[model samples]
Target: MSGFKTKKISKNPHQNPMQVSKIPSQKTGFSSKNTPENQKETSENILTSADKNKRRARKISGIFLIISVLVFGAIFAIKAVGNMQLSNNDEYKTFRQITDIFGDNSETPKTPEKRGSKNILIAGIGGRGHPGGELTDSLMLANMNYDTKTVTLLSIPRDLYVAYSSNSAGKINALYPMGQKQNEGVNLLAKKVSEITNQPIHHYLIIDFSGFKSIVDALGGVEVNVPKKIYDREYPNNNWGYEIFSLNAGLQTLDGKTALKFARSRHSTSDFDRSSRQQLLLKAIKDKALSLGILTNPAKISELIDSVRNNLSTDLTVGDLVDIGLAFKDMSNTNILMYSYNNECNGICMPGSYLYTPGRDDFGGAWVLLPENATRSRVSRYENMRQFASLVFEFPHLQNAEKSIRIVTNSKNLSQAKNIRKNLEQLGFPIDHQNAIVQTGATIETTNIHKYYDSAIGTGFDDNHILVEALKKIEPSISQSTGTGAKFATGTGQYIEIILGNDAKNYFQFKGISASMTENNNFSESNKK
Candidate 1:
């Protein structure tokens, strides 16, 4: 049977009304567990109680502050000794203490070099306790342009099939663990990710499950908008037992465990949603830590540093982090751009879906997602990845224009219609929701564009300069329909009408099989015969 065969997995009747991005699986069973206590209580009560506690803590903090000042002075006086070595000096001792609490400190700080862009690959592992805990659960590439202060977060799916070496082929997440088994570790993983993205991974940060939870707790928890209620009945607990985990849809502050659940829960949802949740949780953690003055308060900073020490590893020194913090301190939430690859677009799976194709591993016969035909790129996955990296890093301006586009395809090829829409969406267009797509089965001979309700305006002109300019990048000679019609009235500044013709196969760089493909294959087979 073809790997694309439709399959259904049992769902709890009480599951939320929101649809999940369907991920096919065999032998799908609960792997870990969470307790009933992990269930999220209504956020309103939690927030009210938290506010009261904060107010109370503020009222009594002065007493502790006064005592600490006196004790610090007394200790300094007692420790004052001449002829103390630099290593034994109290100032040096405090510096070392700070360094230890944080990961590491740069020995000799240097002037910040003017690098046009910086790329950092951040990976999160499940950590020590849980089964397969050491494997990376999330991997993201952060591309920051220091001059513009704009950042792009590109999330690579964990199940992406990448061959780290000629002899080794596995999920991208396994690269780190497999490296560790060979005693090479994260460095090797970084190299592999860099190669895949076709961009240099200047630095890497690996956070384990403990570090993630601890840091969130240190910051008094993070608030995230759970868009839809999540009910993972068989959520994994630490004891190898399943527990029901449920969270209501709302804006709520999540403590360490709850935040982890919000980010890591994948029973009903697919990895795309999980990646998005992880990104949201990360922003929430940053916002909370900043709001709570952890970055400014020495004590809070020390506490957080100590909390994450064992669970975080990175070559980034304290100085490096401080430099980064100061550079992007003024960046607001809007300055950050996020993109992820998904299995489907507009309720239709694109030809040769981006999600990995499941199959048995050649080495062990264990189930794994494998690359059959081309995935991201028409020729190879590597080409596809590099194309994505270039678009992200080189054309950072794409994020600047938040274009809400509605695509209407007039093509007999349903797959081609879906494919074009998927490509446009992948280019970071905010498609006007899922139901916005209109498919007209009528086939034309050449692709034509109707721009802003005007057809005869010119061969290739549109009042929406941004849309026209972006389209020119793909097809320079793309022409307008050259006739005024009621259909042209449907065009908006954000919307474009595409009448796909047979020639569109060449225009969109069409690769996947359709009527044209079948004919080509038949001819080739007959030639072989």
Candidate 2:
């Protein structure tokens, strides 16, 4: 799990068939009871209608030659006042670092070469009523590619088992609880995410329980649609970890207080569902914020910004933020993608704990985890802080060629590393020189990839079907005699590395597991005991 905050954009990539980056649970602003799924959709529709209404209102008035100019003028003036306050707000300034003039000097990077798209990592700290922060409940990577006017947002689930900078591995959310005491909880979370995504995180904003509520409040209120009915007996609220917040399903309007509940509630749907709801609420908030004049009020902006200074941490300068605010100043609430990681990546799981790891024999077919295409793209962004498996599923040459060979490699082996480098080179993939991978256990994952798409929580893969089929296609070598290949394992071993092709061009790899692990016949609950 990493940074997972909501940002605004107008492009609808969903219609084109979405390949999504998940949204973290905490950064989702839906802690209210009113957010049923229907209501959520309706709210989105409302935003659209609002846009149309605004256009129509302006048009009719314009044709009448100031038919309603008197009213609009007064309204605009009132809005201007609030906008002025927010513009001058020091609190907001505190959170935004002025990259250009910090403490003294000025002049910031302007061109693409100098002022490239910056990456900001935002985390949501969850813990009730305490100045000392908590664990990072959600993770998100906000990539603003100013050059393309295309922003790439990726959400990392907190439950994702990832290797941390401390050389520790655990659920992504715990990074906060473990480090927040020192005020670097958010920093550690960002660093972990940076390691995984390979992207240099320029800034971090940590919003604890209260800060989250206030931001929602500042935006007036957010509208949403709750997807499922949720009933949690005792959820966290302050030091009390088991207080319940009940709600029915469907469309509804949520004020700040209720919005916090909805966003924070782990009610009906799975944690994945919670994350989805949170994403929707976030979009609503963004839409409202962009629509309202409050953003222009420098004074109010200062107050709102100041209100959360103690609650946030960032490396961004004022100029950087102001620029970002302006760029996104008119984001339409049209396009958004939200997804969640499933237990399939880890296999079977426990309620709020225990992500299981399976053995090889359990795998039903030859398979590769990452696609040949998105591998470098995913790796460069993560920067190697987290270990990634480029699963190498070997195919026996056709006509019952040689036995299948699955090579598991790690960042350790020198020769296989050379081969991997070759593979990538042949492929012409860009490598992020600053990959900060920290290897943990020696074993790589053994997954039944077919089970991946079939899982209850799958992310859909029409394009990925091609990758799967490609991995399964093994060209056979010349063989007069037919027989299964030999299997050998002598004694205590280390790690294994396998590479495909000569260079980066036709690259696929398996970089872990020195000795083989047998598959389990029963991963289901009924067969377990």
Candidate 3:
């Protein structure tokens, strides 16, 4: 049987959007003279022309509609694929785990009760292909207070001796490696740090050396103001060899590699100084990243994620990071308080001198820093260290005030003046001992705290009232007065002068507030001479 066949017709003259269809005209066949038949033919031609115009319009509209649909479909598909890739990628998975993105409700990010402050333990380690790759090279506790809009970075020395196990003791840096034996390095380290600081550690971020370099490089570079020239004769290289590293003293931009060396070099300078430099680098990186708008730029963020994908580890989730960024969006360098422990003070111990190096014989021939007033049996009970941390975290405003303090006294009250300085220093007050003046005249009867600058004129002194109130709490007898006293000259900038009179002897003599034995012995010896 024969089947009926149907012919297909093309409605569109041109299949491409860019192509145009030509209209035919017959000038030779059509006559200009008016006639009944010619008029009918001309009218028919006009109708045909209008019909073609309508078809062209429809064709163009159809082409545009098709193009828009395809374009939108492709865009949505790309987005879907990107999301899938992120979900499947190892970096994204790690980030999710760190942030607890889809984890159980009970294991969510922790928020502290005290003023919504969050304490994060930041540790830097040398990753694989480097010597002692598992050990932490840098450790810092970053405390963020949303209420006060302040941040405190407390650097923990790697050589700090702490008990990692019930029967074993080692440097705090070793805790990371030891914890990794059971796959709980981050938690173990955070727990140990919490014990020392006496504050709960909310999260942890452990990035390797390579990750640090990649992050800095991704930010283009960081601008750091090197206070003094750095010349390291024994900067470690990748192949277990030492190389010379030096930087000029001034404002300079550092790349990733140079910044790593700048932060890691400790052979020429002490470890405490290195810790300070690390803090400086951190601030520089933060300033640069914020100024560049890394948070909002997708391309830059992608680059950063790629850079640290294999090298970074953290317990901070994407949400937590976003919250942190929003919280510190307007933070300045002044809002950050940087502190570390050291034994560099000459006479009496101060904030930076809260740690002292015990004999190497006590630590298996290893030089380690023990908290001042801490015995070997009670290394974890770093009372002085904890107190220092408390002062920084609690009275951040006082530390942020950065007021220079001068201790003025007569010969009869010199000992009391020194004692007050020690106490204030331990409490994290900025003391201006270099510019102090000592008068050997009659002892005044009343102690007064004098303010040299007008309280309303300065930028950071809005919180001066807090400082005054705290001092009153410490010593209720301390009278507050403004204007520079007669004995001490007005300093170049804003400062507080504590004029120690006979009544100053009773200041800071309360229980649990005793001066160091060194200060006591020095005062007694001077009195005899």
Candidate 4:
């Protein structure tokens, strides 16, 4: 007790309760002085503290790393499950079987014989649980030209009357259900479509309303520019009732249900407008699917697969689809062309109209459309339809050029010039009737087609020989001028000019070509004597 003095422990509220004053001890033989031994012990203590801190840091880092791995693994598992569900889907299996039966299981996809083009018939139905679900609601021939990397979509009206059987006739939409009765709906429909289009149907895809909605939803909606306001007061609803559906004219994104309504609403507008809207939606979907990387993204691919699983059926194999996607990956909107035939024949149908409605009294009180030139007894005549298809799909260059044409005629041959204009317009020619002039002079004796080439304006016929050959098919006596003739100046801004002469009266006549020029009032009234 006499050898060392001990300090008391601090109990003050301001001081740390755990702090205690050190007492000098002689029995333990430890020194507070900074001796070499004490210094070594202090250094060891500091080193031990640093090691504990590093160990704690490592443990925390390890926990975070594990969590990250687990999260990524879960995502991968979900994606795998989605893909597995798609691969094992019953519809996908059926599709594969159907393609195998059709002999479309080759490594390379099949294409049409002409220009390496491929045509696929896309049919949309109402599907199960809906009235007339088996009947095709929409029919379109999608033609892809490999050489030009262009796509042409020709919409066939569902109300078109066609001979489904040798002894029976009905609307084209009914052909699908009729074939389904014989377990050959897809093939039968494709055959009929091929006949109508005059293009080989290399493949076919049939989807129902449910499938369409699902696919559109899975793609996160599509962007479309509605050209006009659509206000359908009698749109069909899910409960067999009518509902008002309206969309303002503008660019907007539409979901699955809204898009279906937009495409299917025909009560307010004509079927032709509905067909155009459908085509517009299709292009929008294509652009979204291709441009948004939906093909490469795992999550999106899984979603799309699940969406189309039981809802979609197609003869295209997985490899074939992949090949198509790759081939069309770089295509722009400019490369795709869309056409539809509608009968607005009140006074006269609009230019390029190929289908006309024969009064319901003719077909058992069922309203239907036949070829513009077709009679009730001859419903199978698709010459005009085929010619239009050829002009669109075969001669895309002419359509792409979008060259303006003018028909010049004297008073004597005015009617003949108008007739020729109708024929050319129906064949998809860009006839500039607004600027057409009627030369009030003596009738010329010869019909001449002058090509006005102006390098400065790029307003000339690049495919002169091809066009001449095509026109010759329409009029065998049509002569092509060797140069931009002095009589027809190039300053008219018209790419091609057909100066009608008295000889033009001998031009070939296309049946069902109405002589009514009332729709072109601007051209008619302006050129009136």
Cα lDDT, all candidates? 0.55, 0.41, 0.63, 0.62
Best by lDDT: 3
1-529: candidate 3 lDDT, tens digit per residue: 1111111222332111111121121111111222355365664355455557754654443343334335553233233222222111122222211222111132335567334677778889887667667678899998888867888888999888765543345677766655555445466677667656666666667788888998899999899999789898878777766789999999999999999999998987888789999999989988998998755554564566557645766655434554576668789888887888777666644465677788865554556788776655555545566656766776776654455667778888877667667766766676555655445576578878776544466432222466665566566776767753334745356556677777776676633322211111111112221
Steric collisions counted per model: 7, 92, 1, 0
Each candidate: RMSD to true structure? 14.1, 19.5, 25.6, 28.6
Query: Tens-digit lDDT track for model 4 on 122-195?
Result: 88877656545666778898878876788888888888876544334556776665554444546667766666
TM-scores of the candidates in the order shown? 0.64, 0.47, 0.67, 0.72
lDDT of model number 4: 0.62
Segments of candidate 4 deviating more than 4 angstroms: 1-115, 345-351, 397-403, 454-459, 462-477, 485-491, 505-508, 511-529
Q: Kindly list the per-residue Cα lDDT of model 1 for residues 47-148, writing each as its tens digit.
A: 455457744653344233334434553223223211222110111111111111111122235446745766778888776666566667789988877867
Worst 10 residues of 1 by lDDT: 94-103
Clashing pairs in 4: none
**Between prediction 1 and prediction 2, which has the larger TM-score?**
1
Candidate 1 regions exceeding 4 Å error are 1-115, 345-353, 359-367, 370-380, 393-418, 432-506, 510-529
For residue 168, model 2's alpha carbon misses the true position, in angstroms, by 4.7
Give model 2's TM-score versus the native structure.
Answer: 0.47
**Which digits, one per residue and each the tens of the lDDT, describe model 2 over residues 413-458?**
4355454333322221222212211222344332111212222444
Task: Please report how far candidate 3 places residue 109 from its true position, in Å.
Answer: 15
Between prediction 1 and prediction 4, the one with superior TM-score is: 4
